[model samples]
Target: MNALRTLISLVFAALLIAVGAFPTGAAAQIGAKSEVHTEQVQARLLAWAPQGVATGAAASGAPGTVWVGLQITHQPGWHTYWKNSGDSGLPTELQWTLPPGVMAGDIAWPLPKKIPIANLANYGYEGTVLLPVPLIVTPEYKPGPLTEAMDIGLKASWLVCRQECIPQEGEFALRLPLRSSTALDGGAFEAALKSQPAELTGAQQVQVAGERLQVRISGLPEAVRGQALELFPETPNILLTAATRGDAPGPRSWTQRWDGAVWTADVPLSPDRADSPADLPLVLVTDDGQGWRADATVSGAWPAPAPVAAMSPALEAALAANAARGAAGGGPAVAPPAAPAAVPAGTFTWALLGALLGGMLLNLMPCVFPVLAIKVLGFARHGDDRRAHRISGLAYSAGVVLSFVALGALMLALRAAGEQLGWGFQLQSPLVVALLGTLFAVLGLNLAGVFEFGQFLPSGVATLQARHPVVDAGLSGVLAVAVASPCTAPFMGASLGLAVGLPAAQALALFAALGLGMALPYLAASWLPAVARALPKPGAWMDVFKKFMAFPMFGTAVWLLWVLGQQSGIDGAGALLALWVALALLLWALGLAGRTRWLIASVALAFGAFLAQAIGPAVLRGAEPAALQAQAAPAAGERWQPWSPERVQALLGQGQPVFVDFTAAWCVTCQYNKKTTLANGEVLAAMDAARVQTLRADWTRRDPVISAELQRLGRSGVPVYVLLAPGQAPKVFSEVLSAADVKDALAALKS
Candidate 1:
């Protein structure tokens, strides 16, 4: 993009240098560049009005006639949004600066496409397009002898984005003859252009209900699908996003929606052009998910009738039979359920604020409290040394912020790739659980005085701790917090949620915000003199307190192991337990073995791991997966299978109305939904009464199948609900839910 900007700059310089060539006239000494090139951009975008458009000047420059053309071309991968950029973005622009006596009409823009890019979606074109802008000549305007040369100039600007956005600018110029009218080629370029989306004759205040964007596409047949249907608004922010359901409308003739809508209609979706003008591109997405390319005029009802024989035999026969039947009996039956009025979509800001508040509350959580205490005590111990205290606090803060920033970036990257992840995703990994388990085991051993660091191999006290005891406390504080990484509050919850939807910078900012919130208490403790004075003195009893602190780490390790067992099956649990045992035995041997044999023993212990692995996973496979049946089932809804596209498809094949809930046990939002919405008696009754087969995709653990399915639906996180009504295509809901919404949907299906 920078290279293109440089080239654009150089071209402008050349154009300025060429200004001296213009002829001097009596009234006005006009100056203009004959021709110029736009920036040599790196394939991000290149849109232009083609000169190949048909020219139909009755007489060259006769009366108000003038030569005009369309020569537009766009780059690959790169695209520019239409008038309405949708959600958040601006459209392409071209400012005409023509010489005196020469004027150009509004440039005609062809249809545009709405392309999905990670969290945000954009509306633009992918390839070259021809936009025809007619040139108009005033009847009295006459070119003087010296100023016969005419110049056309344009200042173009567009927003380009791939992973990040770069604003591009350029100057396009065209030279023209001074004749009354001149002819220009308009065929080869004109044929390649796309047409605008079908629009209503004029602005219509349409009523939206549920997933239906009800506009009167009058004179159109009701039973349209695939490339035959779609909606585009002419109002700003009215249609923030596309709808989430339909093709199988409750009763209406047309309904459409995207995957982000929760529970069908209680939550209103923003129209497609949320942050910009509605007068923009609205490409039609066929029912089959194919693009609806333009074929003809943008002004009247689309698509001239095909030849008489173009109609399908089945459809034609049905129509004929319907006509005969209507003549013999009556009109076809009409069923229109009263659609609930449309509602407004709330901002991601609210969710952000919630996440922030949650981060603040998280400071009070038990898992975090003990760690904070240790951190505070360390500060108190170093209270007399204020500089060291500040450094420690700042180091801790840096570590926390760094951790959250990394996590936030990872979330965004995964989401962009279409993976549905959730909070505590690390906890879902058996390896992480095992590693944490091992860490805790080590911490416990340290507390048990099994061995000592910073001291002689078997000494009760560290060899260096006698000189640097404070160093140990600070290091311990860091590790304690590390061990508590999985325990995040609801505020961290929403920030992570928004992080997935924002640009990397904004996401990192939010992540850093949460980290600051988490570290604020520690900082306050350090600065508070009263808090510093309340700590116990450094003495023999310090050992006891340290040992007592080790117990929490041990317990935490045990909890991690259990979580691992559930995640990795029995074998993983066994392997982890075995690994801990091996470490303990080896350490004990080291403490007792003579120097001559110590090296040999250590080598054997280390090398033995490979031999154990060669013996197969069975040797270390824990006894956990087998034990799961004995444990009470997780509180998943009645009969909801784990999320699997194949399983959901099968359920649909069985003609059962399947409701697949995508959730993770570790996600706070998921837990809230379970406790309040899905677990509610009313929702349960409705589930049973409606005969809805429920399927749960437990994203609590990594499930490749669930992740792929989420990508298929254009989502990368949980709290996704898929409603596959009997004999209809599946529809997705959002991150939130309600019992009434489900009930209404169930009732609609029954009818």
Candidate 2:
């Protein structure tokens, strides 16, 4: 009987151990319920109600309303989300269980800080936050004694994230003695309430079109104008966060500016949302960390979408970082504000006129002189036929205008696609320069009577027919533009710069006007019978003149080859010369007869292919030559340094005056300035005395940075001179530089 009783006791002990080890679902549930009130469940996040009183009464002064606070403390590096969690994350949620006749209001969130995780940006809070909630007490509540109290229970759920995320929930209860009057001190909760964005008091207007939203506010203090400020949208799904415009406008971007008493902002709406709400909430924060909240109403009809220009990659990256910083409630690097439409009223007209004048001046440039001579000879051939001359003139004008338009369109298209190109950008390519050089060489040989192209063609193809005078004139116009591109004459810079920034249609019109101006002289000469009669009759002298013209063509070819060498190095230039030789040999073989000619042509073609294969990679690779480096390096006693965006910014930051020369070796105007004005000892002496930084931006080869800078300055080509005085907007000088110009700019800096 004793052994049985001991065995039964052992069995009872084993059963008790099993019950403790594997509890029932209901028991586990009860334990979890009890653990909700404990602070140790998730140490990373803690939720509690701050000790406070019903702050007298609500704005309505009703007995039913009382303001309270729910405080949350997060561990280091851990954070909870705001109403709108940018990029990713969920917002904190709270559910309240109250007695009869009691209600809870929405959480009044304070301004959130931007939390960046790798490349992703989020809006949340770190450290401690107090969320204010208005509790409504009904009039039916009876006045209670000290032991009688009101029970307020809150169930809080939040996601705490630091590199990883953990979901946490807690139940909190607060017991407060019933009272008619309550005293609440202005502590953390009061400070948080003060930090909340205030409702906008002034008139506000919002405009929305497509994905863009713009807001204008009036009655702002004049002092706020030009101050660094950031905008935050409280409306979820409308905007994740407002991007500070800083100085430069960005695509799908936000920018704000205060115009004296009124402030205007341009905000890009989310692409995923449709139909903007009539009412919007916004928070405006100054650089000093002060914030104001306001609700704005949409007013005005949606405007049509404006054409958006592509921003440079560098600017885009900078703006993105700026936006992130702004979201994080940090001061962002501001760019100089976009100068109020540099092209004002009547500016377009002036630009068109300038383009015309510049185009007319282009005729006097050395590059265009060769083409002009050919046109003159062609004119002599038709001096007697007034009708034919008139028709040819019209055809030539059409060709010139159409070519300019085409070139402008191509440039605009490329710019839209983010190509940092400018005037004569085609010449930046070694292949283009080579092809142009070869064409000039062939044309020179043709003019020198080396071989007639007509003889090589099958038949019915007139190589140089005077009967088709219109065609001849049109071809002449094409040639004129080809050579004219390398030279940027007076008035061209400003006009082209303006054109580059204008609408495509307007830009094309400006280009056409320039072409018309260039063609005007020839057009007038052709149309006017008296001018046509003044020309000397066609004679053997014409042949002599044509041969004379071949020398200039050859000269142009040599210049192009030199330019190519500067771009592709000496070895690449040598390869080009060999290719030219092979091409000449092929032409010679074509002029010969029978199997021997075919064999020679075959051999020439093979040699040309080999040369091309050898040179193609070198040209395409675009390796900077040692010679370029030597040229870029400052010479002894020279004050000029190579231009770089960083160096410019550094000098400007140090309050040093800078004189930048945007130039290229191939640009005749650039070369002239370098030799005549920039190289003058007096100018150099003045620059040295004034301690002005001189920078030379060489555009001999395609540099996207330089190209983008030029675009920013409203220029499309070389020979741009800018004088940046300390703490002042850059003063642009005329493309044609002079000693007086340099001295005046320096004197202005002193003033």
| Residue pairs in collision within model 2 | 64-137, 197-293, 198-293
TM-score of 2: 0.42
Off by over 4 Å in 2: 1-342, 463-468, 594-596, 623-707, 710-729, 732-751
lDDT by residue for model 2 over 56-112, one digit each (tens)?
222224455556555667767778788876555567787877676667889888888
TM-score of 1: 0.38
Q: Model 1, poorest ten-residue lDDT window?
A: 625-634
True lDDT of residue 142, candidate 1:
57
Best candidate (score: lDDT)? 2
- TM-score on alpha carbons, each prediction: 0.38, 0.42
Candidate 2: worst 10 consecutive residues by lDDT? Answer: 29-38
